[model samples]
Target chain A: MQLARKLAAKLVTGLVMIWVVATATFFLVLEMPGNPALAQEAADMQHGMSPAQAASATAVMFGFVPKQPLPDQYRHYLWQLLHFNLGVSIAEEGVPVSHIVASAAPWTVILASFGIIFSFLIGVTLGILTAIRRTTRLADGLTLLGAFINGVPVFVIAIMLVFVFATILAIFPQGGTVSVLETPGWNAGYLGSLVVHAVLPVACYTLAGLGAWQLTSKSSVITVLGDDFILAAELRGLRPLTLARYVARNAMLPLFTILAISFGLMFSGAVFIEEVFNYPGLGELLIASITTKDFPVLDGAFLLIIVAVILANILADLAYPLIDPRIRRS
Target chain B: MTRLARQPGPDPAGSAAAVEAAPDSVLAPDRGALGDGDAAVRVRDLTVSFPTADGPLPAVAGVSLDLARSHITGLVGESGSGKSTLALTLLNAVPPPGHVDGGSVTIEGVGDVLALHGADLRKMRGAEIGYVFQASQNSLNPLKPVGKQLLDLGRSHGERDQRVLLRRARALFDEMGMDAARVLASYQHELSGGMRQRVGIAFALLLNAHVVILDEPTTALDMLTQALVLEIIRKVHATRHLTTLVISHDVGVIGDLADRMAVMYAGRIVEEGPTVQVLAGPRHPYTRGLLTAMPRIAGDVSEARPLPGRPPDLASIPRQGCVFRPRCPLATRACAEAEPPVTVTGEHRFACFVAAQEVS
Candidate 1:
């Protein structure tokens, strides 16, 4: 009953957060100088229509032009959102914003999931090893390496990796999710292309994320190692494996929440990584919509990312009690 | 029972004076010549030291003791007196930056405990000598249930039949007057202080370790709880027929529970005798001062005077002569010149120049 109440509270808070973000983005996007109607007006004027004709034509074509009052536009947008109707993209000429977002969401999710999972595994393992062998020179070297990797920006690493592997070595493809010629299906050939295409972006994500996890986990384990319970465990003559389990489980508690939040961040997409690799993920879609002044698609994309982040936070809060009973008691 | 002479030559200046007066010094007690033959554990010339910025300083300096079979030996001292360090040395587990400089801890069935390493040392710790650490509340893993930790302990010791091990644990908890199943299901935080202390004792004896040590078992408990826990300890120690050592700073706790008691000051045992004899007639000035300072039920509350001067830490402890010379009311020029010798009288032994001369 307590758990159910806690989860319900977190979910309600998450909904409130989504609404706040949507309202803020709504006003902020409208306040920007350009809109799809203006861009259309410019295009029609370039086609030799008079200014008056283009303005009237835009007004007729786009029923909800920027000229409409702010309150009415807001009410209409909220009504559409409530009905789960992200209206058709003005830039895409009748493609629904929701359809565009749905199509683009999967690529980013898979990439981020792979990156976060792989980094978490490698970081946690290395962190444990480093903490156990803390006094040794090798552990010191690993600490220094983790710090260095953490200090360097992700884009720098991505560019260097692209330059070395794709540009110079010519070992992997430079851009795109898959070859244009391959029939997209569950066939071996198609699947192989997908894996090959994903390698660099995934590698970039892992490399970018690995350092922070290693550093956090290393310090966390070191702290637990000094706990009085650990000393008591040692006195009990516990086997190395059993002792490691106690240390690892306790050390992993703080990291679990961070991992969930990182998973949430996956929807926002790694703009630099996706851009560098020319990967057709949500980040690329977001950038395209932004450049074209496609207000509907941009709003839809923002809403999708915000909802994912909020939901992930709720999941983390709910799952905490399962792993740590100390939290459950409170 | 065995007698331990302070090992000589820790300091060059003090060694010459000590050697010259060796015959009349009364420092050396006849080794294994006058006490009980069946000692469960014999500690000989044990000296543990810790490294500091200046140099290595002894925490448990040149100490020797015996835990007679099936008897509770209480070691009493202020914090930092090294009574706890001496207990850890019995298990050969002095924390790092501090180590056993020299010692031989011999148990009945097991040879020199300090010599055992790796698996042998580990096996001996929880199997032969169970240690109930100070602040039993913090000694338990916070995350795991008590039952899970018990199973971990059993598995670590290569116990093939976990069922038997758990049955022993449950029985031990039951004997300690707890609802065994409920306690086993609960985490450390779920239990009260007294309950945790009892659990500590239960864990110590669960593996059938005949030799048990409880370090400040009732330190943080309320007076009523302390009395109850002390009773439980007495009951458990009796039923198990276990050789036990209880370490505490509170003289009242030791006076109430221990059969034999040793008084420690600055990493040295200043006095050792039957608990009743020592309480009734303490020889060393520090022990006398401690007894005088204790708040007794019968005595005038105003008569209790806290010992003058703080207890000496490793850095502050004197380099030569008696460690208690500065605080001793009967200090003389002779007392400041060299260390006092051990003056043995039947089962009681003490190291004090004035006390020995007075006895003579």
Candidate 2:
């Protein structure tokens, strides 16, 4: 019953966070220099409409009315969102924002999940090794390497990887999610090509994220190593495997919190990585919406990102008590 | 069991010689000569040192001690006096920044701990010796259930069957006077301080080790809890027939629980004898000072005078003289010229030039 209450509290907090983000995104997007109607006017003018014609067309586009009041617009947007309607995209003309978001969200989720998991696995392994062999020369060298990799920005690493593997070596494809000719499916050929295309972007994410996991795990392992329990375990004459398991399990507790926060971050944080690769992910969609002043699409993309973050945070909160028993008592 | 009265002034050399001739008179009544099986642990000339930036800092100088079987030998000293270091050496598991420089710790029926390595050392630690760390709460893995931690210790020591391990843990907790089911399900933090300490002791006991080393077991407990824990320790010591080394700065604790006691000063044993005899008529000045410093309820209401100076730094202890001479109230020119010789009277032995002579 207490667990249920704790979980309910977490869910409510997450929902409130998403609501706040939605409201803030609405106001921030609307407050941008040019309104969507004005952007529509500019686009129509570019298509050879006279200024008066473009203005009248935009007026008609708004249902023969000028812009609504801020409160009315907010109510309209919220009502539309309640009915699962994200409206039609202005930039892509007739494409529903929901459809666009649905297509792009999968790619982002897949890439970030793979990147985070693989980096976490590799980083934790290396981190445990370094912590165990802390004073050794090899561990010192690894520490220096981790610091170097962490210091460099993700985009820079992405660009450098592109230069080395794509441009200079001409080995992998430079950018894009998949080949234009191939049909998207679970079949071997399509999936293989998809993986090939994801290589660079995923590599960028992994390399960029590896350092934080390694550093965090290293510090955590070091801290647990100092714990008296560890000494007691050692004194008990536990074998190397048992000792390692005990140490690693305890050390991973702090990392769970980091993992939760990082999972939330990966949604929006993928923007630069997606842009660098031109991957058809939510990040690219958000960037495209911003450039063309597609407010509906922008709002939908922001909402998806914010919701992903909230959901990840909730999952973390739920998993915390399971991993750390002390939490359950309090 | 006539109580030996506290002696005043000095004794003649002839009496000291006569006492040394019949050493067993001061030995524990149940113990015979120091046979291989009689002494559960025998540490001889054990020296441990830490490597600092400047040079080697000796934490435990060449100190020797014998722990008789099924008896509690309390090693009492102020912090940094190498009490904890000496305890760690029993398992040959001195933590980093410190290493066993010289000496041998031999457990009867087990090989020399200092010389053993790899599997041999591990086996020795598993089957022969156990340790209870000073900080009781942190001495347990906070993330694991107490029972699971105990079970893991048992498993590593070759207890393979899960049911057997669980039963053993439950029995040990029961032995510790805790609710077996509740304690088994609880994490370290869920248990109170005293409970945690008892569980920590239970962890050590799970191995069924013949020798248990507890470092400052009652240092942080409330008076009642401390007394209870001490009682439990004494009971455990008696019931298990286990040679026990209890290290603490609390002389009162040692006085209460130990059958024999050794007082450490600046990395060396300053005084050692039967607990009652040593507390009643301490032969070494440092031991006398420690006894005086202890707060008493029955004595006159006088201020407890703490030892004046801090312990000598391990890095720069004087090499040519008695380490305690600088702080000694009875220090003379001879005390600074060389290390004091061990003076023996019956089972009691002390390292002091003046105290030995004056007391004798």
Candidate 3:
């Protein structure tokens, strides 16, 4: 019953978000600021326009289209959103917003997916390690470095990595998802190149992420340390490795909850991070669409990212019960 | 776990000679007339301290007690009385920031428990001295089922196979009058608090340690469960001849299970005696006060009198003085300058400048 209520609430929240985005798209594109048609018209002028067509274009650019009311236009836009009809790009003529986004979504997903997953994995692992070896010199040093690295912004890390690897040391490409000469494909060769390009960004971001991720396990460690079972386990006098593993396993319960949140945050957070590395991810495409007033394309990317994050959070909530039995009974 | 209680403890040579000459060692009331029978644990002048901004403050101050074979000794004190600190000291689990300033915990065969470091101490802790903590629920792992956890416990001690440990775990469950398979398969959360306590008991006892520090084991258990657990402990103590230290604030609990009891206040043992004797006629003013303080449904109304004033703060206790002097009503000028020497009887012992007057 609680799950049903939670899902129903999420559905309502998602629809409310869609409505707001659609309304914002309508006002900002049609009512406010610069003309969407102006960019199209400028391109059209170079190609040559008939007098009637030019006048019609100029009037539309300055809001002459009263044929379709604002509500009707909003409805049309919402419908287009539902049907995956992200309209043409204003920056590049004859280019559809959906098509540009579609071509670039995978790159972003790949970069962000790898980056987030890798960051979470590495971060959670280090956190657990540091938490377990809490008193050791190694753990102390790891905690110190993780805090320092994570304290710095992602862009700073990205730029620094770029300077060291791409500029001064030229070990990897300066920016971009794949090499300029390379054609992106599903094959291993292309995927391998993409990964190679992704390594520094993943490492750079994951380092910052590790501070929070691993710190999660610290609580788990403390919890495990307090567990009477450990004392009992100690009484049973097991090997050092077994005792450590027992502590780690019990501690892993809460870390799972932290992992879910880290996954969501890192994925969405990769947007700016993607642009910084010049990776052709959805974030970069969304920026391009926004600059040219391509509302449909921009809205699609915005809505998708928002929905992705919310869904991830929801999934995390739903999954917590399965991982820790104590939650389900509650 | 080495069997400290394997051989029956004999009388001292003088007592043995007297018994041989008079045929009364078997009926002798003075167990102390006998020599020490390889004290299962000998904690000598133990002082455990925790660091603060000012300095390291002693939590357990010069607590010297012997836990002998086939005996149940109860450590009785209210919270912050340093009973738990003393217990932790015996286990050698005083974490970082806490230091054992001066003490030696000598367990038979295991040697100095406080001195033993790394793997040596770890080995002794589980195999030799089994421990039961207060919170039974959180004491066991939640995710892992009871059986697997038990199996792993055994596996840690070189019993690696699931089948072998599974059999042992089932045997233990059956022995505890619980369903072997159900308890084995059930997770920690699935069981009730009492059931978890039972599992805890099985875990501690199955390993067969001579000394088990049950730090308020039944504190969180229900009344019926407490009775059942106490009964089980008595049964185990009798059958295994285990040396048990049951720490509790409930004097009734100590009276019920302990052969001898030690009363702690401000990290010092104010009184120690046979449970029945202490309850019936306490020698220390604090002990008498504790007895009088216990709420009664059937006792004479005039006899009930609660002990006034709280226990002293061990952190800033006077360097040369009785720890209980601040609260001890009968304390004289002599109590302020030095701790009174322990007064001894056949088996009972009391530490108070006014012990002479508190007793008959």
User: Which candidate has the top score in DockQ?
Assistant: 1
Residue-wise lDDT of candidate 1 within B73-154, one digit each (tens)? 8999999999988998899889887988886787755667888999998987887789897654488877899998998888
TM-score of chain B of each: 0.91, 0.88, 0.87
**CA deviation > 4 Å runs, candidate 3:** A1-32, A38-67, A129-144, A182-196, A226-232, A265-267, B1-34, B300-303, B357-360
**Cα distance off (Å), candidate 2, residue A127:** 0.9
True contacts kept of each: 0.56, 0.69, 0.62
**Candidate that beats the other on DockQ, 2 or 3, i.e. the better one:** 2
lDDT of 3 at B21: 44
lDDT of residue B358 for candidate 3: 51
Task: State the C-alpha lDDT per candidate.
Answer: 0.84, 0.81, 0.72
Q: After best superposition, candidate 1 residue B130: deviation in angstroms? A: 1.1
Question: How many clashes show up in model 1?
Answer: 2
Per-candidate DockQ values are 0.65, 0.56, 0.51
Ten residues in sequence with the least summed lDDT for candidate 3 chain B: B25-34
If the candidates were sorted by their DockQ against the true structure, best first, what order would they fall in? 1, 2, 3
Candidate 3: give the clashing pairs.
A127-A214, A229-B139, A235-B126, A238-B156
**Which stretches of candidate 2 lie above 4 Å from their native place?**
A42-66, A183-187, B1-37
Cα lDDT tens digits for candidate 2, B10-86: 22222333445444332222111243334667777788999988788889988878788778999999888999889
TM-score for each predicted model, relative to the true structure: 0.92, 0.91, 0.85
